[model samples]
Target: MADKVMVDNQAIKKRRSFREWKEDTARRLDIWSRKKPARRKFWLNKTLYLMMIPYLALFFLFTVLPVLMSFFLSFTYFNLLEAPKFIGWSNYLTLLLDDPIFIIAVQNTLIIAIITGPLGYLISFILAWLINELPDKLRAFVTLIFYAPSISGGAITIWSLIFSSDIYGYANAFLIKWGFIREPILWLQTEKYILPIVIIVQLWMSLGVNFLTLIAGLKGVDRSQYEAAAVDGVKNRWQELWYITLPNMRPQLLFSAVLQISSSLGVGAVTTTLAGFPSINYAGHTIVNHLQDYGGQRFEMGYASAIATILFVSAIVLNKLIRKIIGKVGS
Candidate 1:
């Protein structure tokens, strides 16, 4: 009886000690929680937080939710009007194999990206440099002319005049006037010509906007940096641009490149506007167009979602790679 009593007493004591320790721990945690983030630290920035709420809500609603939904939808077949049904890798397989237009779209997109990415960037920088050198009034006028296309990037009327699939189209008319071609060419109809036509349109459309972005970057660059480079015997325009201007403009350049690349790869509207749906011989059908063909028209939502997912992944990978390259070059 004595031994049993002693054992029970020891057990009770251990339980009591454990309970005390847990209570102590809880009290400490409460104190730490109360003490760690002070009221002043939070309330002092209340206005700033309140100001951020609308943006936060908007981001959550539009950007964050859509991305999450799209990712989820990639694994499911969801027509907008119907319930989503799960599919596997079938959509991806079909895209790679059965879809002939997918291949064409990929080729056209890459071609445009390759041609325009470097050339457009160079043109913008040159224009910005020239604009900076000019009188402010003249610069503004020039800037306005260049920026006109961007204001109407999606205007059918502007594109119709240039890419009119007719005998009297502006481009063909000009070419004929200049004795460049004997015939009004079916520019967007043939695969050989479609990609080039897209590139040309993109080049024209891209002018003022990129120039403006580059100009902003240039304006942000410290004048002292250029003066110092000049003092250090930086001779000509190219050297100044290479050493000072390009380095200072790295962030803006990268941002612009990202925007251009994403836009170029998804070359849907221009082709659609100029060539009509499915494009001439599917020559101008881009990934975005393909998605439209499947998702929007046929209501093959799952397949469309898969295409979007693939494009998203490709963009992420390409952006990461470009950023890495820029980091090395900028360094």
Candidate 2:
């Protein structure tokens, strides 16, 4: 009786273990089977996938590869002439701790950003609104005036007038004549004035095109909505404008706002053209200018790549902040 009981206990334990192992094996097989179909389907679309190969290759080549290379380069010291020796964040550390020019550049960039970002958009919005109210015939001419500066602003002649570094340069001559200051202000060379000058120029250059875009947006607004508001005893032009025009032009407003911010951030070419990098006391060095200093002047390809990475990141952060503000206002 004891032996029979022992044999029965052993058989019961064996059966339970077998069942457990079988169930585990079955579950894994089932999972494998399910995954296999997905894999097969993906492979079956080989031709379609092959069609995407070129775009994917280009994406990796241009975008992903550059980003990865920059990230790697940021950890190294490579001047494009020799091997890249890994410095392990020494470059970034030095930038944070000991780089006086970098600190000044950051300060100048922030100042210009604060000045031009909102002011440019606000002025452009006002201009656009005024233009939108005009008759079609006059509107074209006004738009042409506003946009011409932007189109021509990139020219060397325009830059020369603004930043000639000469006593009789256009801005200096005009300011001196007005007795704004006794001496001819070195607009580009002076540390105290370079950033402000750049901001003013940026504002002027951005006014027309952005304003025109806003005007088009305003014109697209539903006239019936305005009429209905007026019929409801809306008080004045200001109220109608506040309620109808701005809300309706949200998309264009957002676009112009972004453009203004981004352009201000990228105000390097003009700076470099007008005031050389390390602008007096390093007051006019923006990230873009910094990148150019490395990429072009020093030929430090790795350092330049790192600077480009930094600029890219800064741009994204700036856009996010601007968008967030716009969202709050729109809401």
Candidate 3:
């Protein structure tokens, strides 16, 4: 009975100590978050102000101003030929209630974003991880092979031949010979096939700068850390990745995630190149396509601005969510 009472008292004391430690940590965190930069530090870094001036000016003109203007114009009705007349929520309301194509575009964009974003990010990271330690010449050759498709503006010509609708086309000829189907599939022309083909092409071309930078990050990880981890009994590849590699690669991972989300959300080039802008039955149409339709072809500047604003906001939200998720890596 005495031993049981002593054990209960010890448990109570331990709980009290834990609570005190937690409270102390909370206070420290509050203090850290609330702290302001010292004036001395700012003055010490005064040279950075001059260095940033050119970039800040360009960014304001090209990035900040355009985003602000787009947001402002979203509430107005303006064609290229006329002055912008304030239409309040009419454009947004129309987007939600009236425009079936807009709905389709949103759905298609989401589908592409949902599919391509994670897949591209994951595949790029995996490839980077695998290639990081290869022979220098071989790694460079492989990187060039993976990256060339993205940089080559005329890459569609190659895909065009491959996915050509005629029986003489590579895919059709192969499929026919294999007895998959008697008829040649209209891969790019048909609504059903257009999106899938675009997804494939996009995936094929997805590894651009993101892959290169991630490989660079992996090369930066200290070799000693891996040796230390091995000593700590982390022999499995998955365990090494989870315990060491991921934590070390958080910045690169987050950056790649941002690029993937941005590219996926803004995926129109593959669709447009393959299926044309309007696409058959609007099946492969995306938000980017819609924006280009209004902003480029129709000259509906206000409506297009609204579309741009929506895409921008979506990208921002997705990036924030990605940051949150990636922040927990290695923790």
Among these predicted structures, which one has the highest lDDT? Answer: 3
For model 3, which pairs clash? none
Q: Residue by residue across 1-331, what tens digits does model 2's lDDT show?
A: 9999999999999999999899988677666656688766665675799999999999999999988988899888888889898988777777678777767777778788788878888888888788877899999899888777766646535865856667768777787788886777667778777777787777777675577788879889999998999999878988887777877887887888777767777778767766775567667788788777877888876667766766678888888887777766633
What is the per-residue lDDT of model 3 for residues 1-331, given as tens digits with 9 covering 90 to 100? Answer: 9999999999999999999999998677556655566654554565798799999999999999988888889999999688899999898888779999999999999988898888888889899988876899999998888888877789977888899999988999999999998999988888788888888888888888789889999988999998999999998888989999999988888888888888999998888888887899999999999999999999888899888888888899989998999999877
Over the stretch 29-76, how does candidate 1's per-residue lDDT look in tens digits?
A: 666556657754655576799999999999999999987887788777
Residue 156, candidate 3: Cα error in Å is: 2.6
| Rank by lDDT (best first) | 3, 1, 2
Decreasing TM-score order of the candidates: 3, 1, 2
TM-score of each: 0.82, 0.73, 0.85
Query: How many clashing pairs per prediction, in order?
Result: 0, 0, 0
Give the clashing pairs for model 2: none
**Compared to the true structure, candidate 2 yields what TM-score?**
0.73
What is the C-alpha local distance difference test score of candidate 3? 0.88
Model 2 lDDT at residue 74: 84
Off by over 4 Å in 2: 1-68, 83-87, 153-156, 162-167, 172-183
Q: CA lDDT, every prediction?
A: 0.79, 0.78, 0.88
Please give the lDDT score at residue 326 for candidate 2: 70
Model 1 bad stretches (over 4 Å): 1-34, 37-48, 154-156, 174-182
